[model samples]
Target chain A: MNYFDAQTWIGGWPFSFQPAHRAATLARALRGEGIGRALVSPLDAVFAPEPTPANRALLRSCRTLRNLLPVPVINPALANWREQLAVVARDRSVRAIRILPNYHNYALTSSEVEAFVSEIQGRSLRLVISMRLIDERHEYFAMRLTGVPTGQLDRFLERHPDMPVLASGLYRTDLLSLLPRHPNLLADLSFAEWFDIVDQLVRRLGARQLAFASHTPFLITAAALAKLGQVGIGATDLTSIAHRNLERFLKT
Target chain B: MKEDGRGRAEAAELIAEAARFGIEHLVALGDVLVYGRRPAAEQVREINDDTAWLVQTFPGKVSGFCYLNPVLGEREVWREVERCLGWGARGIKLEIANNARDRCMQPVMAAAQAHGLVVLQHAWSMTQIRQRSYHTDPEDAALLAGRHPEVRIVMAHLTGCGIRGILAAKPHPNLFVDTSGAAPEAGILERAVDELGPERILYGSDVPVRDFRVAIARVTGSSLDAETRRRILFENARRLLKLP
Candidate 1:
């Protein structure tokens, strides 16, 4: 069955510039391997001082990719967040706006996060908080960033309980640590690695709480797909993880 | 059943059924958090106690190991290790307490050497996870092995540890890696054999967390020759744990 890559990146990044030429090559390779749809962001979000350029670039390139659905990165903390929203909200092509708190240097507790949440909600857009971009140990030594704190996440969820967030860039332990604290938070398992995170998550948090995210180019798409393929879930559960559930939150 | 210690016991109750899928051994690596980051001597005892119970419960089908954190200092590390060995644990398992090369690890490798215990250190690609402190990157495990060549160190998580990890582990003959943690990478196991050779690899499912079926299949379905496959899947582990 086809799986929707719930988390991905496109366009050249200023920090870790992965040009669409490179991204498209990787996506073309993955499409060869059977990933029909991918929810994409910009690597520029991980590096650039501004999100608009990469956001615009991601928007511009996704039209060429039938399988890729653009998920614009919005820094509600930025003074010109309205312009970013106007860009995204003008078209139904982009489904959700992803926020990178650690990368953007804003706390979920901050006014920008609050305003951003309210605006996304006003436009009836979904929220996705990127908890991390890479494994912490391997993160740039000079650009030390930490995952979003559970306490702040809890508070954010408590305050905005109506919003269903797709928390990408989470490791398995972060998912475990937050599962009991926040029921509204749904995590995409692109980076959660451990002894057997799939089965453990299925037991602790149902498959409904998860979606497939290849994290592509940065990770081997087949290897990531194989990770979920190797999960001992039934065809039904696997169906939800691979495509069905993600299709619900994403723009077709 | 929840996949805690209690859940594993329930898993043991179904060992016969699991055997149809070729699960001949279930290595009881403990629920681990019995001793959190800095485990007390009592907490270590409890972890080993549970390990012992699982080993005895499954008999030939199960092997028990002791988990230690040397950052707690020598006394606590030695006490639980010695007690677990006394209680019939097969080896020692180390988690993210400290890197394998840390001065803190000296006493731990010493204890394993003294007790003739096979030490399983939690290892992953620090290439991606750069924290070298408590997290033992594969290079650090290689450093540990370069120092204590006589003691056996099985670096954990073959996939998370990745190619560079296998290469880091290749220099020291005493260092072995188990096919545990993460889903099986498509070709890393083949790369492991090419780098470390087949004998240095062992088959382990960080079970209840990873799929034993796929973990076993990584070896069982490898591109390696038949003897090497047999060596990786059964013989290597059987020799390591000294299973009858």
Candidate 2:
């Protein structure tokens, strides 16, 4: 089945060794792993105080790669976030924009985040909220950034009940817990794992809520696909999680 | 298997799940030290007895590994090893009873050597966490292997051990690392192959705690050549266990 990676990154990471982060390399590598498309973001956005330069670089790098869709990172906490959003939204190719709440040092419940959600809805773009890029237990010692708490997500969802928000890098338990409360929240399968994860997830959350996400360059792409490939689920559900749900999530 | 301290899975269910994954053989390491890092003699016996029952019931499908708590003293360690071996156990399973580098392990290694059994030590790279006292870091496992060259030591959790864990296991020919623990981090299995060779690594699904599908993917989804992948997924483990 053709897969769409909802979580992927390009550009160098602060960590020691990372796989090929160039868009061209990533596109080829992901294709080899059976992924047809990826929602690409800039790794520089995780550490940078401002996200415009990194987002622009991501757009430039992915210009030629049709399969690699550039999803710009927007730090809503920054003073000129509206300007950054305007600059990013001008490109017709930009169907979605990502936000790093923990790294950007703002509460998800803040007015800035609420406004950003409203603006994305107004502009007809999808929103991808990165709960984490690295595993919390193994994050670089000095960097020490925790994942966005479920309570915060709960609160954020409460404020915007109708907005369709895609949360990347959530643990299986976290996903299941937050899911019951917030029906509008969708998740990528990048970080969720277990014995028969897909089967287990489908039984609890249903197939429509999940999208395939490899978190490539950071996670083994095949490992992510293996979950989809080996799970004991129906073909229709498999197709939904693998690509169709993500396809619908993106604005036309 | 994957026990998250919440619910319990039946043995019949586990067997069926393993069979579904096309797994014919299993290394039955008891829920050793589930009570804590240092379990009482009764707890140790109970855990090992559970493993024994599983092995006996499954017959050809499962091989039991005797759980030993060296900190419980040399006498208890030898007794459990001898008892479980008599029940057809082929190896010793050591959890966080104590550090692999601790003095307590000497007796455990001696028992494994005398019995001609493999030793699977639960290890991860504790560099950042720095709790090397009770937790068996890859370095400590390497140190144990380095000290007892005669004993075959399988360090558990490749991703948990990370690159440093692989590097530590590189020099010790007697040391092996298992592909278990943590989510599948990209490029780790390849780096492990480059540093320690495919034969030195074994595929392990810390099942129940981790998903069998994802665990298999950690090796199969890697960029290694088919032969190397085969070795990791099947051949190496088969040879190590001396199974047909």
TM-score per prediction, in order, is 0.71, 0.94
The superposed Cα distance between candidate 1 and the true structure at residue B199, in angstroms, equals 5.7
**lDDT (C-alpha) at residue A21 in model 2:** 77
How does residue B187 of candidate 2 score in lDDT? Answer: 76
Which consecutive 10 residues in model 2 chain B have the weakest lDDT in total? Answer: B1-10
- How many residue pairs clash (N, CA or C atoms closer than 3 angstroms) in each of the candidate models, in the order given? 9, 6
Question: Model 1: how large is the Cα RMSD against the reference?
Answer: 5.7
TM-score of 1: 0.71
Model 2: per-residue Cα lDDT over A174-248, one tens digit each: 888988778788899888877778899999989888999999888888788888866678999999999998988
TM-score of chain B of each: 0.91, 0.95
Provide DockQ values for all models, in the order shown: 0.17, 0.63
lDDT of 1 by residue, A115-146 (tens): 77787788888888888766554444466677
